[model samples]
Target: MRWMKVMMALACLGVVSACSVVTGGPLVRPGEPTGVLEIANGSSHTLTVILIADCSGMSYGLNRLPSGSTIPPGRSYRFTTSAGCWDVSAGLAYGTTIYETRFTTQVRPGRLTRHTVTGR
Candidate 1:
């Protein structure tokens, strides 16, 4: 019976450890005279992503992604902008929670600049 108790305790521990928590964050990098926005998913399961961008009083861009888009646990995807100031937010679909970020584009004279966003 002592061995049975030990096994039961181990099984409980395993069950508790198997539960995973999901985390999401924004990542950015420098692109060619432009800016790239990246969102990172750090969880054991898949996540639904929504992207919204504020482009300097111009147009707002919206994107929706399905679950299992599979950013994986340690990977990132990039979003690029055409013009103006850029603000990006990413959140899980069917949820009100969101992460917001603001970044500027580096447009040089006579040359186009591109910025890249990374989630590492």
Candidate 2:
């Protein structure tokens, strides 16, 4: 009788544990959704953007660094970064000259930031 009671208790515990595990919703980091960076080229000539990003918070490591001279005019390039902060370095290519600039941004999840470059 004691062995039967222990087996019944163990089975009940297992079922309860399984239910909790199975019914738990997806795990999302605090302030989830990540961040997006968009570079819009409004300059009349074809432009290229070389983007480098350094990120921190929530997820760690791995940032996209884009290179090569061909972003095209009136086009936008969008990339996602971590949901906290990013130090972005951009190199703009116009004609045969290259100009470099660096800036930092605090990013919130699901928000889009558009940085437009136009004129001389």
Candidate 3:
């Protein structure tokens, strides 16, 4: 009976630990000519985010996030872009743990444009 109790306790602990796992983050799709980026913060705290295009070194948009702004723990916010070469970065503050995604423009005639991006 003592061994059965120990196994029950272990099973309960395992279930609790599995429920505490963190999930959700930024997701970008590159196959579309124009599309939006979906960002979800699953942590217990709010996250300030700045999104920028790597080519021009300009920020496309900014958001001062509050808890439950996107969805519950598994929800998200999205940002759309026109047809162009660009990249995205999300971080806590000005420059901390920034994540990036680079994309290229669709080919066009009579307009020669090239973009080279270095990820950080």
Highest TM-score model number: 2
In candidate 1, where is summed lDDT lowest over 10 consecutive residues?
20-29
| Per-residue lDDT of model 3, residues 1-116, tens digit only | 99999999999988754433221122222563545444554443333553444234333444324443432333455555434454444443224554443353432322333332
lDDT per residue (tens digit) for residues 61-93 in model 1: 434344456344455665544434454444432
Query: Global lDDT of each model?
Result: 0.43, 0.58, 0.43
Residue 27 C-alpha lDDT in model 2:
23
Reference-based lDDT, residue 64, model 2: 36
Error of 3 at 49 (Å): 1.9
Give the least accurate 10-residue stretch of model 2, judged by summed lDDT: 56-65
lDDT of 1: 0.43
TM-score of each: 0.36, 0.52, 0.33
